[model samples]
Target: MKLKKIGNVEANYSFWQVLVVCSGQEFLDSGEDLIASFEINSPDVRLVLCLTDDLLAARELLKSLAQKLIALSMYELELDGDVDDNQRALPYQIARNVLLQTRLPTLLLESCSFVRRDITLLPAELQKADCALKLRFNRKGISQKVLTNTLWLLPNSRVDRFLAQAISGMAKTTSENEERKAVYKALQACRGFLKVAALPGRYADRSHKHEGFIWVRLPKEKAETTAAREFREKTRARFARPPEVIILHPKQDLGTKSHLENNTFKRRVERLARPGRIAWRQMARLLVELSWERGKPARLVPLPQWKITKEALKNYEFAKTIFVPHLISAQLPHPKAYYYMQELVPMLFTVDRNGWGGVDSI
Candidate 1:
């Protein structure tokens, strides 16, 4: 049977809308340093994979995510013309048949619009297969609870098959222990909020360049008093690099919804929690500030959106300052926005230190 097209245009719009909605909602606000740290430590999570004919849809989703999410990218996989030839099939097809089927389908039920619509139409065998597979996979050497937690929601469908196969491929390339350890180590680094490189772009051929900045998370209650100073000193002693460690906490304000009536404000807040500054920008701002506070003459170039000026750049270098790039409004490609900031902050910091002053702004 020929697989039906879900209208790439429609699918793309649908996917884009999903991304925007998810991004706007408080999806990852629980101070999950794991996600942020893993992105910095592992490349796989950084790149997003899409398997559809809708290139426009894929692009839209990728661009939007690069702008909003911490670290993300999009890739399009092409299934071969030969329907029965499994070797030539696309990764997404495998994902559909495998990952989305088994317990993984449950995730779709929770978050994915596409998967939810199709779950009701899948067969019993596929569902059963998915559940069994998840049960077995979770028991395997891969001990990470996060991956298992995500897979427990798979639906019984061809989608499950595809995901299973894709995951298998990932498994073969890297052991589960390796992945889990990597995640743990990265989180350890980020918990105290160190500056790191940005995530790689997900598209198959995009240049993996550092884009911007992000402030990593720290362990809870460690930044309140003398503990904060000790933490900073420990960082200074360990890396010989005392970074500008910023402790971030959520704050409620009436800036965006203040103009509305009380009821409307309440509704908006209820619908979705307000988003904080992306981690990368927060890191960059800190890097600039710390360089100045330390009496290190540096060049600071604030990206255009951040609003640092060219004169500000000159000021940083002339008087124990840090010059950041001036903020520009050009739209960035996929994954660069959040991922690159990790690398970008340090690069800018290095530049400021080397007396490379008075360059381009924003």
Candidate 2:
């Protein structure tokens, strides 16, 4: 590959300065898995065998995937302790830790996502945002938001300002290694802070800040949290060519799940599934119970209620109370739902629920 220079920076080469992360082999099996069928030049992306102390484990995986990855660029990072709550703070803390240390902008992405186009290949709208998040629609409705999903692209400098402050506050009280676990644990509650505050539209007075945040929808073919950004990118590409709506009738609706028409319509809807019947039935009952107990108008927990300032968040009571009835969710987050019928919820934590248990996806 050859590089061209423009105004002192390498033209296409410098644009996609990414730090691809594999939290465990479970998160990203290999670098090639990320690009999948795409024809990505190795020079365009950087890879990391991230988040495990065991170097030998990292080395073995890299040795196997040598066809797609450079041996030198894939390095191991170890955080102390089990620190293993998939929904909590590991990925954010990992990104925050790396971002604070590095000068270039780096995004945290899982191993399963297919990069049909590289970050260097992105448009100006996506490039300039404070954070580019993948989003999913919750059960409430198309208009209702669940939470931000996978494949987050946050600026290293901006992450320093938004994420690291809280981590630093706790660093004084804990050992460096313990801080890794603590940051993630605290992040469970702290996520409410970002979802409510850092995310632009949760409040009225909050700034949209150039409409700089992105919340992309996921593909129907795979698991919801897997960050199938390529699906929507393909849809956007299709729109530019022509508008072709393929309508299907009741008889046209295939009785079979694998019919071509059914698949096409599924793609158009973007959300092919919803939560299980049991979960919905259970949720209805819980809502009834809440109504009886409150005995008045159902309280509204309008977010952005707490001032979006460092001091307000750093205060003690905010974390504990954020998810209380009028705050985030109304229902007592009872037993974990056995399986979600839809793939709406994101990785960090489920929306509206305060406790740190994960909602299983269909």
User: Top model by TM-score, which number?
Assistant: 2
- Clash number by candidate, in order: 70, 5
Q: Give lDDT tens digits, candidate 1, residues 93-185.
A: 334443322222322111111110111112122323322112222443444422221222234333343343444344333444553433333
The sequence of per-residue lDDT tens digits that candidate 2 reaches over residues 50-166 is 534344665455445443321113334445563434433455556666555443345555554444322222323243454544233334432223232333344444445545553
RMSD of 1: 20.8
- Per-residue error (Å), model 2, residue 146: 5.4
Q: Single out the weakest 10-residue window by summed lDDT for candidate 1.
A: 12-21
lDDT of each: 0.27, 0.33
| Residue 12, candidate 2: C-alpha displacement in angstroms | 11
Error of 1 at 315 (Å): 22
